[model samples]
Every structure is written in C-alpha cells, then in structure tokens.
Target chain A: MTSIATAGASVTEQHAAIAGARPWQRLVLLAVGLLVALGLPWFVYPPVAMDIAAWALFAVALDLLLGYCGLLSFGHAAFWGGSAYATGLIAIHLGVPFPLAVLGGAVFAMILAVPIGYLSVKRSGIYFAMVTLAFAQMLFFIANQASSLTGGENGLQGVPRSFFGIEAVETDAFFFYYAALPIILLGMWAAWRIVHSPFGRVLVAIRDNAPRARALGYDVERYKLIVFVLSAGLSGLAGGVFAVSHGFVALPELHWTTSGEVVLMTVLGGIGTLWGGVIGAGLIVMLADYLASSGFDGIGIVTGGVFVTVVLLFRRGIWGTARHLWLNRKRS
Target chain B: MTSTTPTPRCALRTEGLTKDFRGFRAVSSVDLEVAEGTVHALVGPNGAGKTTLFNLLTGFLKPTSGRIMVFGDDVTGMAPERITHRGVARSFQITSLFENLTPREHVEIALQGLTNQGLRFWRSEKLLGRRRDEVDRLLAEVGLTELADKPTGLMAYGQKRALELALVLAVEPKLLLLDEPTAGMGIEDVDRTIELVRRIAEGRTVVFVDHNMHVVGQLADRVTVLQQGSVLAEGPYDEVRADPRVITAYLGEAHSA
Candidate 1:
C-alpha cells in the first residue's frame, strides 16, 4: 500500500504506482473479478466454486492481519475450524437459518480471538506465530476429546443449510454459491474498507514500525488486538460459510496444516494486497480440486512446488510483483 | 539565552529519577528541572545515561525509583502515549519513522493523533483533509512541503530528520524531549535543524542531548553535564563548558578529537 509517488504526481499515476490500479482501473479489476467469481461455477463444479469463495474470504481475512498489520498467525485454523464447528452445532441444535448460524459462528470466533490476540500481540515475529499456533493446537485437542459435541473424528456431519426453509436452495450447488457469495463479498468489502480507512492507515504504520507508532502516542497493543479480533471474525465468517457449503465440519479444518495451507495461498497471491488472497485461493483450491479429480494424490508436492516457484520468482507474490512491473512500466 | 526569574515554574522536573537494567544502573538518582519556555541541553559522554534519562522522562522506560513531573503533573511510570497526552512529545536519537509512509502521511498521522479521529476505522482517510492547512503549515515550517508526497524510505537522511522534526512540531507539544536531535545530519542539515529548533522553541520547553558543543552553545539556555549516570554540573553553557570537572569528563574528549 506504500506507493512511491513523488510530488506533483497525478492521482492516476500515484495510484497505479502504489497500488497497481487507478480508481477506474480498480473498478475494472473489480468487475473482472466479479465476472470470474460468477462464472466459475459454470466452468468448474459448483462445489469447487463455493470452496473458492470461502477460501478466498479466508485468505483475505488472514491478509488483514498478516499483510496490513504485519502479524503472521500460524494458528488461524482455530478461528476457521472453530467457527465451522460452531456453525454446525448452531444449525443442528437450534435449527436457525444458516445465515444466523454463520453470524453466531463469526461472533464465537471473535470471542475466541480476544484472549488469544491479547496474549499474542505482546510478542512479535515468530513468537506471535507460535503463540497463535499453540492456541489453535489446544483447540484442536479440545475438539478431538469432545467427540459427543464435536462428533470427534467423524466430524460434525449433515449440517443443514436452512435458507429460510427453502427446499431447492440447500440441494442446488449454484444456488448455494450465489447465496454464500454475498457473505464472502461482504467480508471482503469490509476488509477493503478497513485497510483503506484511517484505522487501516494506522495499522500500516504499526506494521511498519510499531515502536514509532507507540511513540507517536498511539496505543500500539490496542491497535494490534483490535485488528487481530477483526481478522478472526472475518476468518470465522469464511469458515462458517465453508461448513455450510460442504454440509460437514471436519477435524482437518482445525489442523495446523490447514493453517499452513491458507498462509501459502496468501503468499502465493500477494501478502498485503487485499485482493491477492482471492487469486491465491483460486489457484491453490483449483489446483487441489484438479489434482483430486485427476486421481493425483501428490497434491502437497505440486502445491509446494508452485509455492517455492512463486516465492523465488515473485518475491512480492503475484499481485505485488505485478504492481511493481506496472509501476516500472509507467516510470519508463 | 533567557535567564529565569526567581523560582520560575518548572516545565519539567525529575525528583531523583533512576533506572536499573539487569543490575546495571544506566541512570542513577538524578534531579533535573527545566524552567518553562527555555531550552535545556543534557550534555554527557557516551553511555553517561543521557538517552536513558530521556527514555525515563518520556515513559519509554519506567524509572526504577523516582518521580517525573511534566508541567507539575506527576507522570512517572506512565505509558509513552499517556505521557504524550500530557503534552509531552519525544523524538528518538535514531530517527524512527514509518519508512513506507510519505512525509505528508506522517504529518497527517501526527496531527490526527492530537484529536479523537485517529482510532476511527470506519471513516475514510479523506476526513484527515480537514486539517490540510495545519498539515501544510507544519510541512512548510520544516521545509518539507515540496517533498511531502515522497515515501520516507526514499528520502535523504537530512530530509527524513526534517520530516521527523515536522512530526514532533505537529504535536505542538508543551515539553519536547528530543534525543540527539541533530545526530547523523550533514553540516547544512544541522544548521537548518538548529534554526528550526530555535524557531520552534519559542513557546515550548526543550530538553535535548547532543555531542556538538557548537549546537549546544548556540541553542541551550542552560546545560546539565552528566557523568556515569549522575549529574556532574548544571549551569549556563559558558560556565559549564569551563567547569574543570565538566572538561575532565566530557569536553576534554571533544577538544582532543
């Protein structure tokens, strides 16, 4: 987000240089992204499209903390999987509408984030990552032992998608995608709005130099905690949606590897670019889906290879490097 | 240098300030008092606890045992931000800035800090434009108006220092603690900074640490010499400069160099 625009630079030039798109260009990009999101179900399986939407939201939420706030959370699965289980339980027992369940799940995630973020934000860098990971692992074990509530290894099965009791909506994949798209998009828009707001600017400053931020009379810890909670809430939203989409909540969702996978997706797309997560999620999810369909069991090998290539070739991830190129092109 | 009247109000006073780091007493019991609207320079040899004293006053480091009073308000052991809210602002000896941010953004952030809107996440950054005139004035005050849009990472050391000064000035602080304000500056930049400091020190109490005797001689109304974390001498620049102990402790090294 730190654009290297000099004095007297035009707004478009500055935007293009700093963010890789001007206002109109961004609108165009948004339009293209929307079209792809809408059309993906037609090209791929509708279930896969829903997965993309859900995972994209997940990556974007993670990016809010990792990219904008300079926090790397290695245990975000606690929020995602924890929410998935919550949404499942809420839907199963309460028989509420899936939207309400999702909302409840998101809130639960935020509540979970409070203590986790409070402790984790105090330690930075790898320690922050480790603290978050430890919390997620603890949750994973709790869910494992509480088989009666969580369905144990079998996972929470048959989470009903009660779209106001609409019969066709639950059975139809395309309908469900459209239904979940709004929530995912809303979450994404909120992330965009947050990173673009004055609060986000402070987050960027905190990420860049926290001590400087604190010295500037900002409560740096407070800012980190708030962002951490926000990110967890958004991640919970994505997880709740995913659980509803798949009609099941599995133990793997809360696993450390799932956390690692989302991190990989975020890095592949672009770390700080809010939209980059969507692209990264699209690639990884689609690749995994394709590999699964083709009976290729080595999904990790291929994804890991792709990740290495992206890190080596595109140090700024796909979108950041693209923005760099665009800026250089404009400069030249 | 303006001489204080009898019993001038203290802008900042430390009653036996002390800080111990893992058995090393970086700062021992030191009583420091700065009269209102005057520049006080803390001159000491390397590792003489000048920076440590600044840190304690600013609440970056909690004092081991003592009281820090800013404008007669007890501020000891308070957080740095709280200390700032009490009209005290500090600049680091090492320039600490958001490297990815522009000078304009830095000034805006600092200006935003003075009000209630800085923590508002829902509002657009456009709201900061209401203080555009103030931001521009501060930028112009520090001669950063032309380069305000440039990222600080791309800025020259002198320009970055100037921007840092602008940020500090934007706070409109009552008591300004500048740790090595002129450190790592070119000669022209140092002269410019001295002039800028002189201009801004009119209505504020300034405490600073500097090695350049010329800068201290030109700016400080009074000098406090420290040695091994204790106050050695305190007086006007000429008197302290000529003090035998002060010479043996600090200025002697400078004269030799």
Candidate 2:
C-alpha cells in the first residue's frame, strides 16, 4: 500500500516480487505462504482448506483494525455472522444471484456497523472493546429473536452455491474450495496492499500516537471510519463465502463466540502483522478440527489454554516470531 | 534580519483566551496577536502555563472562556485537525513523530494532508514528487537530508527535533507554533535549532514557547512573558528582560528549578 510505483511498489511489483524472490528469499515469504495455502488443501481435505481460508480472511479483517489501527473490536461477529445470515436470506428469499447477493450482504454489514463503530470509536481502550462486544451481542440476540426472518436457531439453509452464472461454486468440497480460494486470495491481496500504502502508514501513526497524527493534520476519525468500513466489508466477503460453502447460514454465525474466534485468530497470528492473522486462523481451525475428531470433549478449554500460554510466553505469535527472527538474522 | 514584523491581516490572533482546569486557571484572560511573518516568542519559567497556553492556542485545550482566532477566523474550540487544516500547524515539545517510520515517510504522511490523500492508501505518491522534494528540502533546511531515509527512532535527538520542524513546516501553514523546539538539546544542537528556526522565520510567521533566554533573545522580535496563566509582561526581549515583575514571577520560577 505504501509503495509508490513512480516511487515503486505497484500491485504488480508486489506480486512480481513475490514471484521473483528466489523461492526461499525474504521479499516473497508471504507470497510463498499464499502459494502453500493454495496447495495445502492437497495434503488436507478441500473443505478444511476452504474453512481455513474463510476464517483466515475474516481474521485478517480483524487484524487490520485491531492490529494495525490499535483498535480491538469484540463485535466483528456482526460482520461475519450478520453477513452470513443476510447472504443466506437473500439467496433463499430474494432468489438473487449468489455473487450479487453476497455483495449486497457485505454492503449490509458495512452499513449496519456505521452507527455502532461511530459511537464506539468515540471511546478508547477497554471501553471501545466492550462497546463493540455489546453491539455484537445485541446483533446475536436480534438474530435469535427474529426467528421468522432468520429461521431462528436452525438458521437459513439450502442457500444456492451457484453464485452468479458460475455453476462451479456448488457445495462440492473441491469446487467450493477453488471458488473460495480466489476471493480469499483477492481479499488478502487487497488487505496487503492497503496496509503497505502510505495511507496505511498513517493508520499505524494513528495507532502508535494519535495526538501526533492529529497534530500532523490528519483527520484521525475519518481514517478510522474508512478502514472500519473496509475491514467490515472484507469480513462480510468472508461471511458470504462461508454461507455459500456450507449451503446454510445460522443465527450462531452472529454469536459473540464467533467474534471471539476471529479475535483469537488475529492475536494468535500476532496481531498487527498481516500474514500472522492467516497463520493463526489456519493453526487454530486445524487444531479445532483435530481436537473435535479426537474426542477432545472441550476444544475451547484446550484452545483457551494455548491462547493464554501464547499470550504469556510468545506475545508476538508465530508470524511475528518469524519476522523477528528474520530481522535479527539480517541485522547480525 | 528584516524587521518588517509582518502584520498580514493578523494571521493568528486570540481574543480573551482562557482555560481552567478543575476550578484553577491554567491559562486565563490572555489575548495574543501574532503578526503574519515575524517570529514571536512566548517565554516564561516552568509551571507558568507555557505549555498550557500552547495547548489552548493550538486548540489542544478548550478555553473555558475565550475565542481563538486563526488567520482572522474565529476557531475558539474547534478540534486540532480543523485548526491545523486552517493553517496553524505546530511541533510538539517531545518531538512527536512516527518512530517506526523513516523521516521521508513521516514527512510524506504530513504531506498527505496538504495533497488531500487521507484514507486513500492505495493511491499514495509518498515516495516521490515535490512531496519528497519538499521533505528533502525541509530536511536540508534543518540539516537532516542526510538522514531522510533513517527511521525516526534511530535518529539523533537533534535530528528528531529537526524532523519534527520539517514536518510542521510541511503544511505551509499561515502560522507555526513551536512548543520548546530546543528543549533538552545539547548546546551545539540548540544553537543549530535556533539557526534553523531563525532562517525559516525570515519568511514565515512563528510564535514559539520556550524557556531558554538565549534562544528567546536570539530569535524573538517581540516577547510575551507568562506566569501563573496570565501575561506577566509583553514587549521586546530586552524590555521583558528588564521588567521586574516578569523576573519575579516567571523567571524566578526558572531560578528555583
């Protein structure tokens, strides 16, 4: 995002650099990660890769605000879950094209978040986190209570996977994986661009020291709002993908636990580092899947335990640790 | 120096600016009119509300009871960014800059304000243009061009101060406010800072709050001495230096410190 092409760092250069790096080189490690992500499904099942991709994109959205902007939202479930049900409803009720419906659902999520984010951004620290959580919980209850519109706890089912005219998006495990891969990749690419831009530099400035950013003549509120909307919109994209992949959308999609899970993914991947979010999401989701099949009666307890341990011992997360190691290696 | 003492439509004028914190006056009943193109100095001892006055003047502190006029517009309690947009950019006493960013990056972000590129991350020209030229020139002006690509956190104290000055000047404001631009610098850096400030004030209007009498004397065309939230004395640096009340009230505190 911060790279000037005239100065250099166009989206093409970024992609090319990723491609051009000598495989194990530093400049394209993230590119390597994405390549592995594309191929990782071969080793694992397609559904598993698709699930990780969706959650990874969602977690990246969270990382954008929480990690980069220094704003930790406890209500991202509003984007994730709300978009899921909304996409489901539009697909089932309006009979709209899947791609268009998902876009509409994303727009819906962005709009819904305006007031909540507006008011919440007025506060800082735990208050900001709590306000977002409260809004998310409110969304959860609304989803549950509006059973007629939402199909209650059972959620809306039988969502058409055929997004737009593309019949390739049906609920087949492999097809769904391929269908979601591009969107997820695009989301990650866009996010990576945003964070690397000069505009992205200002967000970090706002996070690191807001008073200074303001003193430098930045309308901090405007920057925060724009990114908030963008993050929510991308998260909404992930939600849309989720609904399409499963052929169902339920009220639990908006639940606070879902919100918490995204937050965990962001933090566990090392909040503020873009690639960390994806790594964290994949690790956690893969762990959850493993534990679920292994008859681990309480996945949350184990997940929670690991989360605490990571927070205590390795606060930077796996990706952050890698970056740290790389920086050190170069310096020495 | 050109003693024109620019009076360009009263670029930054405050009428009856007052601020109270918890029933105590931090800055009270103060009126200041800085001409459009001369360097004005606001000098006083520590704990005499110099920073508080700076905060109020820069819109960081809301006046309990007064109007702050910038470039002849009444912007009494407007937020800092609005005031800054209206051409009243300032530098912090502590050199508030993006630590992880290079001086080039910091200056570019500041330039984004002038170019109207807020929140449009993907369309930034930060690494090029008159923007970089301006940053480089300003860095050169403040003797920091050699370190333009260095991260701010890694710069020497003097270089950081110089970078902050470059950033403040980046907006090309009608008035520039410096809050202790020379604080905590070694004698050589302080001398260099005064030289840079004096060079820039030749064409720009400035009102800085500082404690160093030497810096104040070397740069100020006119001086305003503040003590306990009110003006103790206002005149040429020589006159303010002679005033007994100014000494007993503001300078006396510096003596104690």
Candidate 3:
C-alpha cells in the first residue's frame, strides 16, 4: 500500500510538471513555426498552402470552444460558410477591399453567432451540438434559397481581391498567401493567450467540474457564451479570408459536412492543444488533396481507418499523445 | 425556558423553504436560522433531507415558495455563483474537484474568483504571483503544503478533503455550507479535520452535515436533528442526542453498531 501510494504521488507530480510547456520552449517553437509558414508555399502549391492556413484558423477557433470550453458545436459551418458568403457578396457587389470585406464578413458571422450561441449554450452535450447543427441547417437553407445574394447552387463567383485598395492580389496566389498568413497567426496567438490567461483557467475549471466552478463564484454560462462567440468570430475570420483567397464562396462551405470535416481535423490533430487544430487541419486538407490528385475514389475508407486507429491507440490525438509519451519517457 | 432579548445576528436564514422534484416534496417547508460566528450541524438519517436543505441554502437548488436571506438580504432563486459572490461557499458530500489539476491550480482558480481576476483573459496567470504568499499560507494552514503541486486525483482521500477545505476558505466567505466534510476518513483524518474546522470557524458562520456523531458532538456549537423531511429536535448536541425522535431516527443503525 505504501509503495502504491508513492507511485501515485510521483506520477501526479510528473503529470503536473508536463502539463504546460516552458515559456522559452514555446517561444522557440513559435519562431520556428512562423519561419516554416512563411516559406511553406515556396515548396508546395501556394493555393493549397493558403487553404491549409485558412482551415487551420478555423480549426483553432473550433478548438477554443470544443476543447477549452468543453462545448461540442456541430454547426460551425454556419460561421465558416456564412462569413464566406458575406465576404464574397461584399467583394462582388460593394467593390470593397479584401481586408474590409473579410472584416465585414467576420462581423456579420459574429452577429449571427450571438443568438445561435446564446441559445445553444443553454443546452449541453449532444443537445448543444444538435442545436448548433439545427441552426447551421437553417443558415444553409437561407443561403441556398437566397439565390440573388448567394448565387444558389453555383455559389458566389467573381469575387475580386482588392488588396489594400489595389487589385494586386486578384490573380496572384503568392500575394494572397502573404496577406492571409498574418491573420491566421494572429488568431493562433489569440487562442494561445486565452488558454494561458486567468480566464482560460476558469474555462478549464468549468470544463473539469462546472458545478464546483459555479459554487466557487464563476458565472459558468456567461463564460461559455463568451467563448462560444469568440470561437464563432474567429471561425468567421477564417471563412472570410478563405473566400477572398479562393475568390469564390460555395454552398458546400455552409454544409454540415464542412462542419464535420473541421471536427474531424480537430480530433485527428488533438483536441485541447491549440496547435493541434492547425496540424489536424493541415493533415486532413493534405490527405484529401492527395486522394483527389491520385484518383482515389475511396478516400473516406482510408480517413475512417486513420481516425479509428488514432482513437484506439492515441485517444489524445496526435500531438497530445506524442507529448504524453515524451513526458513519460523523460520521467522514466 | 427564559429567552434572551438580544437582537439575533443571523448569518443565514430560510423562510418556508421547500423543494419539490416533479410532484414529490423532498424538503417540505423548512425554516432554519444559522447565527453569525457559530458552527451549526444538521444531523439526520439517510434520505432525511439534510443534503437537500444544504443545497437549498447554498443556491444549488431553488426553493419552491420560500426565501433565503443572507444577513437580511433575500437572495432566493439566485444563481449559485451569485450566492458565492454574496459570501457563501460550499463543498460537496462527495469529493468534487478538478481531477486533472494540481492542488495549487485548484487554489489558484478559487483565488482568481476571490481576487476579482476571474475574467482577466489578456493578462498572464503569473501575475497572480503577487498572491503566492497567501496561497502558501492557505496550503500550509490545511497541512497540504507538501502536496500543493500534486494533482488532486492522485492525492489520498484525506488530502483531497483538506484541499477542498482550503478551496472553500479561499472564497473568504461569511457563510460556509460543508456537506459531509469528513464523511469517509480514518480516525486520524477525522480528528485533524475536526480541529481544522474548529480553527477555521473562529469568525465565519458554518453549516455542515455529517454522519460521524463524534465529530459533530465535538465541533458543532448547536445541533438540529431532522426526521424524514422536518426538524425533529434542535438544541445542544447532547440534548438533541437524547431526544427520543432523534434516537429513533438512528435507532437501528446506532444499536447495531
């Protein structure tokens, strides 16, 4: 009994020590990451890189809600696709610059998110997810039926990228990549800051034991709503940027399948770790791209198999599992 | 009996407090008053509505057709957090802690609320280093300084109880509702906890429910015994213990043991 007790104590100490990354290590990793992100398009197709960055931002936004806040939203496509359509519409009709249009789209998506999030957060677990999914379906229906605004099935096309009042990025993928990279990085930084802040600590507490947090004088629902809105705004930012980068907003952007895809990305990369979402997004996007290029008709089977293996063997997702193993190895 | 004519300083009071689940009344109309700076123990047999009354007082459950007044302020139907904000904190009968968090993290989270920094998202948590001395003092008080960095899940049960008490004290609450604070503990742990409670209740008003009669007999300044869903007897521990209804409530279990 004494030996068992000692073992438990040591394991807990090691776990606590490994829970957070050291500041200098995080800084070094961030620097290396930024350099790789800046040079990534030079090696791969710039458009694909841009896609990865946008989806990475979206996944990070979802992670803020799903991972940190313990909220599983199944209708994030509303923010993504809704903002994409809004950004495309503004660019096509109002002749606004890309930055303003993306901002406008993001703001519009946040406006939509307020009511949806307010209602959805009132429920929890599968009910919360279903409510979000229901709201997204509603938005999808609106986008499809409003053919004059959204272009129906054909989607909103001919979205000109007016870069800083100059149409320099209209046809240049590299210019678009440079422009989108900073926004994605900023979003990533925001998520990291939130997770490290006092507010973030409360979020984790709520995630762990909400009733206890409430008893400790935290307005748990208010915190959940704040995170939900923040996640939606970030997601909208990604969608708006994606619309500008691609110069089009398709109906599929708002589809439930799109929401599922991002969820898959977050889970596959790792859930709670902020960078896990980015890695998951990159992996899924790359896998789908490769499958499409190789004429693999059964991409779903392969992806499903990968997901099953990850769930069974590495439940913490790729990054979390890796960190856990590395920490245990170091301890031993 | 001659009653004193002094104005009673009640820290917490319930007026016709009742709770109904569907149609079944778990706690019938119950009026309770806990005076300021006293450790009041509510004792009852299993399912005698002790936990439910504790929940009603702490704002975990809304009272049906009643008012909960804390220091003369009617705070009925308020959210649990709001009640906590108004200087009430509680612990569960079962250990309810963030299993993944270290004892230090649990205290820090509670301190975040107490220090009014719970909403500060942009600042680094290390800014709370200013209060490191206070956190250390609290941990030391509970004799948990050695296990401060350990995750709560890995701590021995007695350590978790101490940690929970430290967390409850972190709120600097005027009223504390501790549900079975020393429910399942060894004799050493129970004695230590009784001492800890006695020390902490120096200025604060505490309402606790416990199954351990010895701890209650030692710590409670006054005792209220519940039968079914109503208070059957109220007096000093010895006086309430001798009450026929109170004894009958625990007759089979006490005699068997």
Candidate 4:
C-alpha cells in the first residue's frame, strides 16, 4: 500500500498541473469570442456568422468523440442531418417556440444516435468507423424512403425562427447570430471542461491504452459509449440550430458527404487543439462559399488538393501548428 | 493491511489449467500452487507456455480446462480486469505502459485504483492525496522516481521493468503475476530489480517468469520448470535445478550436481 507521492519524488508533477491550466485559458478565450460574435453581424452578414456558429458546434461534437475517445465515426451526418429534419418537422408541425423545436430536434437525433452508437461501440479502430458509416448510410436510405414524413430527397422547407418571442426575424438579420453564438460557445467551453477533467484524461488514456485502462478498473467501453452518445446528441444540438437558422431541413445534410466534410474540418483544423474545431469549421464554411461563388464547380478538387497538402506537411492543423511554432520559438 | 495469521501460505493455486489454439495445444494440464509471503519463480525455455500460463492465471487468456483460485476463490475464466479487481495484478511479457503518456501520469492512472474512485470525475484531485502518496512510494520502490515524468517510451531498459512492476503495485494485489520480470535487463538493473521486488512485496505472493537460474536461486523459495507445453520439473530450487530432467531441458543433456 505504498502511496504515489512517496514513490516518485523525482518524476516531476508538471503533467497534470500544466494540462489543467489550459481550461481556464479556454474559458477566457470563449468569453472574448462570444462578445465579438454578438457584435459581428453589424459589420458582416448575420447569416454567415450563424452558419459558422452551427458548423463550429458540429465540429466540436465530432472532436469530442474523435480527438478524446479515439472513435472515428465517419457517419455522424445521420445524427446531424436527422436532427435538422427533426427540428424542421417539430417547428413546422407543432409550431413550438424556435429554441424548443431545435431542442426537440436534437433530442430526436440523439434517439437515432443511441442504437447506432451502441452497435458501433462493440467495434474498434477502422472497423468501428466503417460500421458507423454503414449504419449512417442505412439512415440516409430511411430519410429517402420516408419521403412523406421527411419530405424525401427534396427536403422539408420554410422552417421558421421564432426566437423565443423576441420577434427578431421581423427586426434584423443580427438576431440569430447573437442567439446561436452563446450556445455554440457554451458547448465548446463545456467540451473543454470535460476533456480536461479527470473524466477527459481517462478518455485519452482509454484511447491510447484501452487494456491498461480496463486493468485500472475502468469499464472503458462504457465510457466510450457514453461519450459517443453525448457527442452525437451535441451534434444533433448543432444540426437543430442549422435548420432553425436556414429555415430549411434538407436531405443533403444527412449524406455521407456532410460527414466527410466535418471530418475534413476537424482534421484540417488539427486533430485535438482546443479551439481547432471552431477555427476549422469557419475556414471550411468560408472556403466553400468562396469557391462556389468563384464559378469553381470543382470546389472538391481545390479543397481536396489543399487537404492533401495540409496532411502531407502541416498534419497538426492550424492551432497545433501555431502552438508548435510558439514552443519552438521559445526554445530557440 | 498485514495479515496477523501466519501468512495464509496457500495464496494462489491452479488446478489442471489448459489452453488450446485451433486444435494445437499451447499449455496443457498444468498445476501450480504458490504460497503466500514468498517469491515463487517459474523458469522455462522459450515456447514452454510460461506466458500462456501467466495469461490464463491473470484472465487474459481463458483456460480451455481447469480452475484458478486466488485466496481460494475460483477465478479461472474471469476477465482480466475482473481478476485485477479481485486483487491480482500483472505485467505483460511485452511492455504494456501507455506509450503516449509520461510514466508519472501512467502511474497516477494506477493510483486512481488505490483511491477507489475509477469513475469519479467531479471530485477535486486534492481528495486523491493518499492514492498519490502510494503511487509515489511504489515508483520509488522500483527506483523509477527519477524518470517518472518522462514518457514511458523514454524509459531505459531496466527502468521500464521497474515501471511495469509499479503499475501492478499500484493495485497492491494479494498475488502478483509477472511475465519475464527480468527478461531484458543489464546485470546492474537485474540485481536492482531483484532487490526491489523482494523489498516492498515482503509478505505478498509473487509468481514471476525468469530465464536466469541464479536469479531463481536467489529470489525463489520454490521453482517450477516448464518445457515445451508441460511441467518439466517442480520442487525446491535446489531439487528442481539438480534434477537430471531440468538439466537436460536446459543443456540438452543430463549432468549430476
């Protein structure tokens, strides 16, 4: 029954001490970003910032399961798209308040994520990723087949933004950005807190050494399943926001293409950097918009070519690259 | 928690443990009994199913037949983690430390076990002071205190062995199974490790696999020699080492002492 402190006086206690500091810093950065976002629409378009907010939340959710738990789910579009459909469906039919409809849609998306995440949890690595993809494809078909309910391939349209009785839609475009910005920032901040907590450390440990984590008396699979579901539920949260912001729920959002796009955003931002997901989402959304307007039907060609270049050289993404440069400069 | 009674003396026992991989026998019908408060050594040539037997005992590999008893509870086919929970900790023949993490963090994960808080995330780490104390003590025991914060990949040959032992020690098990605890250490590290293993585990049962005969003689109270897939010899260190059978297994011929 020897204690850890008495045993290793020389193994410096800096790891946790250093890692724990990042969270408070993240919170500060999030507060600053939220403030800027609140006023962003006065300068730029509100819809653009709102789009970035939704996509940012989506990328953060993806990173939670991918960066922390090490589950590479390529089929997350099922939940994201499903949530969009759910959000739109509830708003159009039930005429619930806009936030409540989004919440309902996200909950429905979570319902979908449960079974798929459950079966996929039994697998690991590429097999787990592929299994999720397969299940998502099945969902894509269900969205297609249930055209009457889902509005099919063409998608359900004219979703309304009721803005919690603000009558903001009648006021100006700036309304939705301020509303959605707080939630996305809060979501990212919450993600930071979870990943840095003892729980988050265990997830990283599970990812790196599952057998060891199991040996440490952790039901590693249970932790993985919980995170998987939570991340999916959050993605649904983001998707609900998307449908509310755009006033439409479409089939294309649920496609594997959308899943691939999120993955690319996460990777292109650098895998596990704290704000990397948000930054990645911003760049990708902006880049897609730029490419489409420039008459480049081959945005894929341009983006894919850039993706290859990034992976080949700066595999760490933007934040990672910045951190590395900071540390390297400090050292030299 | 030192036992007041004359240390049970019958800590871990195995009865007819067997394993088969696709109709090929890896380990068959092996019985091993180890007393409490003693360092028992297992010595065998390579491919003697020593690692396989370790796996069966630790619940990493299921026995096709037979039973494993720890403090007389039948733990034969239980999962590895469950077995670990039942006061049996192990080190793999191949090192199993978290490669991406520093050794200190690796040991903290182990210390978390000692704290009885595997899933407690909301509590402040300040509450884990006692567990952290034990982890540091074990690291110091293995002489790994100096290199603890370094990544496990940065560990030197003998230090890695010591770290592995500390990982198992984190659980402070009643019975410890070590696969090749000294398989790849230089002379200096091997001697340091042998002393360290004997010191902290003074009253615990230790079943370790080793290839060095001198190490067995110096450390073991009883020795079991495995050859191929069966027990070649089992007795006191001198008795087994002196046996013509064990000599033949090691030297490929019989010689009297």
User: Highest TM-score: which candidate?
Assistant: 1
Which scores better on lDDT, 2 or 4? 2
What is the DockQ score of candidate 4, to 2 decimals? 0.32
Go through the candidates in order and give each one's C-alpha lDDT: 0.87, 0.79, 0.84, 0.76
User: Largest DockQ belongs to which candidate?
Assistant: 3
Residue lDDT tens for model 1, A41-118: 999899999999999999999999988888889999999999999999999999998989999999999999999999
lDDT-best of 1 and 2 = 1
Give the per-residue lDDT digits (tens) of candidate 3, residues B50-110.
9998888878888877888898788898989999998999999999998657888888888
TM per candidate: 0.95, 0.92, 0.94, 0.89
Screening candidate 1 with a backbone cut-off below 3 angstroms (N, C-alpha, C), the clashing residue pairs are: none
Residues A202-309 of candidate 4 have per-residue lDDT tens digits of 776787677777776667777788788778877888998888888888888988999998888887776756467787888887787788878888888877877788
Report how closely model 3 matches the true complex, as a DockQ value: 0.63
Please list the residue runs of candidate 1 whose C-alpha ends up more than 4 Å from where it truly belongs after superposition.
Answer: A1-16, B1-6, B255-257
* Predicted candidate 3 versus true structure: per-residue lDDT over A213-259, tens digit per residue: 99999888888888888788889989999998988889999999999
Query: Model 2, range A1-332, lDDT digits (tens) per residue?
Result: 11110111122232233334474575477668767877877887777887899999999998888867888888999998888888888888888767777777888889987888898888877788899999999989988889888878888878886655666556467866876678778888878878877668788788767888888788888888878888898899889888877889878788889989998888788776777888888889899999988988799998899899877777677766665565557557
lDDT of 3: 0.84
True contacts kept of 3: 0.69
Which residue pairs come into collision in candidate 3? none
Each candidate's interface RMSD (Å, one decimal) is 3.3, 5.8, 1.9, 3.7
Q: Tens digit of lDDT per residue, candidate 4, span B56-123?
A: 88777888998888887888788777888888888877777765567677777787754446455444
Q: What class would a CAPRI assessor give candidate 4's docking?
A: acceptable
